[model samples]
Target: MTNNLLNENYWTTRYLNKSTAWDTGEVTFPIKQYLDQLDNKEINILIPGAGNGYEVIYAFEKGFKIIHILDISFLPLKQFEEACPDFPKAQIHHQNFFEHIGQYDLILEQTFFCSLPPILRSDYVKKMIELLKPNGKLVGVLFGIDFQKEGPPFGGQMKEYRKLFSKEFEIVKLEPCINSIPPRMGTELFFSLRKIQ
Candidate 1:
């Protein structure tokens, strides 16, 4: 189902038809706040499922020299390229997240996790562990409420996330996001998990 439902064609079609309700057009509050507090400009960072990646642009503008953005669909990556002409083309990875192999000091998640099939959640955790350097982090927001609709914007609760992630990570912060966008307010959880040895 994942190979069919959440594949490149599915997302590429979403981008072509302007069906991206998840595209916030700018950086959302929780992630922006996290980025604002980062003191290191040289940290290796990766943003996967980074559709029209506003966070990538934001990090680059802040002088982060090692920012990589990946999208299975080439559509959003193309859009990002046109939008940020100075960003190095080599840094944009047009590939599947599961097939991506690299180490990062930090991996920023926005809408990527929930977009995957819930059955692949375990794979997501394992792959995250593979991608992070020792003590590196996976930080971002996740849906805190169950959605009434069938979705790529799938919903999940904190309890499930805790159970799934705690086995492999040091759960630093997994709580209600106090600074989500107005439409998503009270429905999101901000999380920061450190990879365990």
Candidate 2:
């Protein structure tokens, strides 16, 4: 499918039809552990394409007050608002990630990357670099294997990922995730990339 087909309407329809199999219902293990290890709750954080805002809620409840969640679609953001009314409404952004502005101390990647068309991978990296502060981090899991079928849950291998990201960021950690949830156990790589100065 074309990039245009994967726009707001595509995603919003998926949410409306309850076709979001990617919604894990709650924060996943890898992300939960990464957030758990953070000693500084005040660091500015962003979760782009944060459908349902699961991690957003989790981080807020844990005292990370400066966190932000962005999504192109409004339905899930609306749902998230109802679910976490205590969360500051201004911090919830209903905008396209590529058009988003602001620098973050850290950006959490969940299923967002793979959800985009492969053609946008480089643009995704560029936007990430643009959005991060100097020496800031982009950390999360990525699929470590390829899928046989076409995907919004598209997959990729480690070497290709390394080549794509290493040009602009320091690959702090890019290896098999030992803490992935059961179904994703051996298929994901837990990565931490620091924006190159």
Each candidate structure's TM-score, on Cα atoms with residue i matched to residue i, is 0.98, 0.98
Pairs clashing within candidate 1: none
Candidate 2 lDDT trough over 10 residues, lowest sum: 1-10
- Per-model C-alpha RMSD: 0.8, 0.9
Q: What is the C-alpha lDDT of each candidate?
A: 0.94, 0.94
Candidate 2 lDDT tens digits, 57-132? 9999999999999999999999999999999988999999999999999999999998987888999999999999
Q: lDDT by residue for model 1 over 17-120, one digit each (tens)?
A: 99999999998999889999999999999999999999999999989879999999999999899999999988999999999999999999999998988989
Question: Candidate 2, residue 147: CA error in Å?
Answer: 0.8
